[model samples]
Target: MENQKLILVIGGTGAQGSSVVKALSESGRYSVRILIRDSSSIHATELAALPNVTLFQGSQDNQKDLHAAFTGVYGAYVNLNGFSIG
Candidate 1:
């Protein structure tokens, strides 16, 4: 799968992130790595069950975790926690 594009998705267990993961995974064009805080959580477990979707245990608050998640990824989709009207 080296030829496939690697996309790192932060907050992939949340509602917004889960949608993005589903969409991208269905596209069959990219491999997705989801950054989740708890691998044993229900959402994380569900996402991990999907094909082409791997879970990376980490947190946005840690620079080291973020750095590790960003490695070798062709692209990234970061969804921070908050509500905003735009």
Candidate 2:
């Protein structure tokens, strides 16, 4: 397992997440994982192929899945979906 710090990017397949993922990946210092809705989604597909990128397919409202995504993670960049609070 990589000992590098992990960055859990919520909404990672989204615009901002994409930027962060790209920047972090280029930095060569952090391992990036994304919390996505579906691994089969096109956005997820794109993120999954990124170097040093991992995907956890779940939404923010699903605490179980969210917890799994957070597991062993060092830090998080979260942008909660609006519908999640409603």
Candidate 3:
């Protein structure tokens, strides 16, 4: 991986996102930034404990937030949290 490349991880506090964070962080390869709606949320706080993990306020519907989160991002992992129809 490139040095200091930012990877913006959407829904990083949820189940799948959390696993991604762990894998990325443990590898010590890329920088991970988590986009969360609430900074004070439990999952947000948990993710904040990991090294090289930055948490910022963001939402999918808000284009501005998405843009801000993706600024200087070398990669992005978008994890939609809604349930799917069977």
Best by the TM-score measure: 1
| Predicted candidate 2 versus true structure: per-residue lDDT over 6-42, tens digit per residue | 9999978777878898888878789998987778988
Positional deviation of residue 30's Cα in model 2 after best superposition, in angstroms = 0.8
> Model 2, residue 30: what's the lDDT?
90
- Candidate 1 yields a Cα-based lDDT of 0.87
Q: What TM value does model 3 have?
A: 0.88
Better of 2 and 3 by TM-score: 3
Please give, for residues 12-66, the per-residue lDDT of candidate 1 as tens digits.
8778989999998888888999988889998988888887899999888789999
Leading candidate by lDDT: 1
TM-scores of the models, in the given order? 0.90, 0.86, 0.88
- Candidate 3 per-residue lDDT, tens place, 1-86, comes to 45867899987877899999888887788889888888898888888888888888878778999889999999999888676311
Question: Would you list the rank order by lDDT, best first?
Answer: 1, 3, 2
Lowest summed-lDDT stretch of 10 residues in model 1?
77-86
Ten-residue segment with the worst summed lDDT in candidate 2?
77-86
